[model samples]
Target: MGFLIGQTYRKMVGILAARFKEYDITTEQFSVLCRLAEQDGISQKEIAARTVKDQPTTARILDCLIRKGLVHKEMSAADRRSFLVYLTPLGRERLDVLLPLEKATLAEIFAGLDAEELARFRETHLQLHRQLDALHQQQEA
Candidate 1:
């Protein structure tokens, strides 16, 4: 069981790590940028919820992105306590470059699988994720 779990996690991490390295960004940071790109002007708290990261960890990652001029944070006009985050021009450009590589990486990973296998794999993956989410909710409860 342990071996199976380790292999599954390692393969997922290895692929992401290699692609992240190619783009000179860590996996966590890329996730933040992708989230911001999709949901621009979202609050940091919302980003943390979406990313399943703690607030402090998300804050630190955002700080690095801000320093690199990839993201800008502005005080939310409607909410004095919250700040809205959006990608800077540089961030959008960088993400544009990285997205192609991400697509290529995903293609490479799925290349050898036949259509039926691919469908089955996705179905199983989604099922597993649902089960995991249920477990997480149970634990939280």
Candidate 2:
């Protein structure tokens, strides 16, 4: 089951990555963009937390996005050492273009499942995620 789950996750990401190829971004990068779209001007640490990525991984993604002119970083007023990340105007415009494409891609991917089945699938994944999160927290403690 774990293997199948991992396989399916990769397949899904692959499909999305292909769709995003012309935009010169990966699904991981898009995830960061989506996070910034929801809330801008947040610290890199906060972005990493919201995106469920480690600091270094998040920084690397930010670096790529920064290079692509999709996002920008500025020194935080409260902390000179830390930087706040924001979506540039180009970033927002790109995100706007991609949002509907993303929705369409997801709809096509889930076309086989009915609404109820999709709900159950989501619920099950949420349960598993919560369980894993709790286990991780326990390990950390």
lDDT of all the models against the reference?
0.89, 0.95
TM-score for each of the candidates: 0.87, 0.96
User: What lDDT, from 0 to 1, does candidate 1 have?
Assistant: 0.89
Q: Where does the lowest 10-residue lDDT sum fall in candidate 2?
A: 9-18
Model 1 lDDT per residue over 54-96, tens place = 9999999999999989999999999999999999999999899
Query: CA shift at 114, candidate 2, in angstroms?
Result: 0.6
Q: Give the number of colliding residue pairs in candidate 1.
A: 0
- The lDDT, on a scale of 0 to 1, for candidate 2 is 0.95
Cα lDDT of model 2 by residue, 61-135, tens digit: 999999999999999999999999999999999999899989999999999999999999999999999999999
Instruction: Specify the highest-lDDT model's number.
Output: 2
**Clash-forming residue pairs, model 1:** none
